[model samples]
Structures are given as C-alpha cells and as structure tokens.
Target: MSATRPTLKLTHSGALQALDGALRKAEELGVPQNITVVDEGGNLLAYVRMDGAKLLSRETSMSKAITASSHRQPTSRLDPRNEIKLAIAGGGRLTNLEGGLPIIIDGHCVGAIGVGSGTGEQDVEVARAGLAAIGAEDQKP
Candidate 1:
C-alpha cells in the first residue's frame, strides 16, 4: 500500500446537496447565513452566503470548517483547549463559538461544514444535517 496524503476536495453533487440542505434548514430556522465546506486539509470545497449574512460570517464559517477538518475535531472542542494556534476563542481566531462540524465517513474525517448567522447550536445542527444530506458522516481524509 502507498502512503496517503490528507486532502479536502468537494464534488459538484455533494456540494449541491449540502447547500440545499443547509439553505432549507437555515431558512426554516430564520437565519440568513454563510455556509462553508472544507476538506480535511483545510481546503475550500464549497461556500454559500444567503442575503443578509454578515460579511464576517463568510471568513468565520470557512475558518471554522477548515479548522474542524485540519484538527479532526469540532470547533467547539478546540475553542476551549488552546493547543493549536488556529484555535480561536476571544477577539480574533474565527470565534470558535460553534457551528463547525467534522465530516467523517468510514471512520475517517474527510471534511467539515460550518454554518453561521444563527445560534451556535443552530449552526451545529444545520451543519450536521447538511452532512447527512450527502451521507458524508463517515467520509475520511
């Protein structure tokens, strides 16, 4: 077997499915938001921001998703235990509030999705739902 390099890549179908799920759920939750998907290597896969989403949420969502994948942990977990420089908590550092969720499949983390502009809990919910939309919960890096 050859050594495998970690990476994050988005597929057209997967992106559309995640976007659709997140958009629908977010509208139902009544929050205009920015949703981001990044692969395990902290690479951008897909990004969508509904009208009225704060400009800050765009970068924030991306950071959260990327962080989740890079660290193979939820943004919330990293937010508290400051072991990685990318871990954000106070002013600056992606907020680390919540919403970033890891995309795990086959016992491996392949990517992550982040939802912004709603409560932290809502962000996490919608992000999880989005991953479920495409059956990405078991994806691996």
Candidate 2:
C-alpha cells in the first residue's frame, strides 16, 4: 500500500475563541445573541448564549450551524425555494433559516457559524466576527 499523509477537509476548524469573538460582536452591536460553531460534519464544537438572549435562538443557532456545515451554504439560502424543502425533506441536515454562515478559507469550506436573537442582518455581522476571529474567510453577502 502507498503511504498517504492525512489532510483536513475543512481549512478552518471550530474554536472556543470563535465563540468569544461572536459574543464580543453581539455586545458591540448592543444585542444579545446565541451563537454556535460547528465542524464540517455539522457537529457542535462551541456555543454561547448571552444573557437576555431569546430562548428560541438556541435552536436557531444550532440549526444554522448544521445547515451551513452540511449544505456548504449560508442559512440565508434556506430561502423558501423548493431546494430548501428538498434538503429538509431528504433528511439532509441544514437549518434552512437565516443567521448562519459557512466558514471558509482559501476558497475551501471549513466550518460554520450560527447566530440568533438579533435581526438577520445583525446575526450575520456577529457571525462574521466569529469567522474572522478564527482566521476563517468571511466573504459573505
């Protein structure tokens, strides 16, 4: 057998610092939000919910991360398009909701960040901070 070196599929791995970065953004934005980080496989890596954050944000954050990680698409893609329904109906993992973004590096998808409790726009901004903090590319729209 030929020897092969192990390589990581996702360039950016989830980190607790990412969660902190997101929380900092939430504080800066004057909003409390629940944030989640997940690996390429949609497995939770780190999570944090600020005080006064909406309770529903917990599930939103988790689902967002899962959608971004598994679908390699931003949660915004969960637009009521039929594609989203298929993704959910096929038993494919994805939050199909807004406020989630995929972490990328060198044009490669690494992981994902999910933010909730704030407006969709604010959630994107907060999630961007987390990705940037962890050295992940944030070329989100």
Candidate 3:
C-alpha cells in the first residue's frame, strides 16, 4: 500500500492567523467571542475563548465548527427540523445559529471555523475576518 493518501488539511500556522484576525474583528465589534476550528473530519484543531466571552459558548463554538466542517456548509443553512435528525442519525451535532463557515482552498474544503458569544451577525463578521486572513473567504461555498 502507499504510505499515504492525498488530502487537504489546515495548518496550525494558518489557524493561528485566522484566530488572530477573528479576535481583532471581535475587538472592533466590542464582542468577546469564542472561536473554534475543525478539520474536514470535524475534529477540533484549534480553539480560543476570549477574555469576557461567555463560558457557555465554548461548546456551541465547537459544535458550529463540527457542523460546518463535516457537512461542508455553514450552520446557517441548517434547518431547525434537521438539527435533531442530524444528531440522532449519527451525522454529528449541529447548530442552526450562524457564524459557522467552511474553510475552502483551491476548490477543496480544508476545514471550518466557528464563532460564538456575540450576535449571530457579529459572529459571522468575525468568522469571515478569519477566513479573510488566510485568503479563504472567497473560496467558501
């Protein structure tokens, strides 16, 4: 067998840049946000809960990242009804709240980012800033 199969993955350096960018945006919006990053397989890669961010948002942020990375779509597109089904059906946990985004590069999904602890719109804005940091915003589906 071959030593390995070709696949796209997010680098820690890239994740850090994204995180920094998101945090900066959150500061601009006066929001202390929780941010999460996950691999395409929905595995947690990086995360941060900014000072003053709600402790409850930690799980939600990870859930959003998992939902987006595994489903290859933003959590905003997930309907309420399907949320239950997706979880029960072993599709993995999901959240309907916005701010979750898939990270795409060169036409392939590398991972995802999720932001919480703010209004849905503010979360999304911060998440987009993260994507922009790695030049992945325009690549998103």
Candidate 4:
C-alpha cells in the first residue's frame, strides 16, 4: 500500500473565529444575515443566523458554503447560465453568487464561508471578515 498523505483542515476554534468575524461585519453593516462555514471537503463546520434574518437564506447560505469548498473558489466564478443549470439539474451543487469565499491558507484551500440575507456585496463583505479572522487570504469577487 502507498503511504498516507496529510491534508489541512479547519479546526472548531477557527470556525468559531470565522463565525464571530462574519457576525461582527454584519452588525457593522446593520444587516442581519445567515452565515455558513464549511470544511475543504464541503462539510459544514459552523453556521449561524442572525435574528431577523430571512429564514429562506439558511439553505442558500449552506449551498454557497458547500459550492465554494467543492470548487475551491468563490461562487461568483460561475456563469449565470451555469448557475441556473447547476441549480436546476446539477442537484444544486453550485451557485453564481458573490457571497461565497474560499478560505485559503498557505496557498491551500482549507475551507469556505458563505453569507446570505443581505445584498451580494454585503454578504461577501461579511464572509471576507470571517476569512480574515482565521488569517486566511480573501478570495473576493
């Protein structure tokens, strides 16, 4: 058998820091939002919904987080047509929104953050704050 390879992963403490950062930004913007943080494997690591945030944003935030992690890039990279196709036929595995950002550390994608319930720009801003808290590079659109 071949030797096992090591890989990076986001820790619970890191996820908490990301969540706190996102919430702080949302508060500064005075916009309630739902935020999701996912691991490199596209699994949820942390999530939160501010009071008064639209309930509908919950799933969208999660989807955005998963899409970013799975693609190892921001969701904004997807074209509108592709976004529609993926939403309708690709099992919602992707999104074409600006609120999702990959968490890159040491040139590697360790996770992602997605924020919803505000304008795309606002959401992305919040997500960027989250990434920054973890000392991850921002992958803004």
* Best-matching candidate per lDDT: 4
Q: Per-residue lDDT of 1-141 in model 1, one digit per residue for the tens?
A: 769977545576677788789888888888888999877676777889999988888877987787777667677775445544444232344445688888777667877887887878888878877888877762222
Q: Rank the candidates by lDDT, best first.
A: 4, 3, 2, 1
Tens digits of lDDT, candidate 3, 62-120: 88888888777888887777878877775556777788999988878899999999989
lDDT of 3: 0.85
TM-score of each model, in listed order: 0.80, 0.83, 0.89, 0.93
lDDT, candidate 4, 84-111, per-residue tens: 7778775875777778899999988988
Deviation of model 2 at 130, angstroms? 0.4
Candidates sorted on TM-score, descending: 4, 3, 2, 1
Q: How many residue-pair clashes does candidate 4 contain? A: 0
lDDT of 1 at 111: 78
> What local lDDT score does residue 44 receive in model 3, on the 0 to 100 scale?
79
Cα misplacement distance, residue 84 of candidate 4 (Å): 2.4
Off by over 4 Å in 4: 1-3
Indicate which candidate wins on TM-score.
Answer: 4
Residue 7 accuracy (lDDT) in model 1: 57
lDDT of each: 0.75, 0.80, 0.85, 0.89
Best of the two (2, 4) by lDDT: 4
Per-residue lDDT value at 34 in model 4: 99
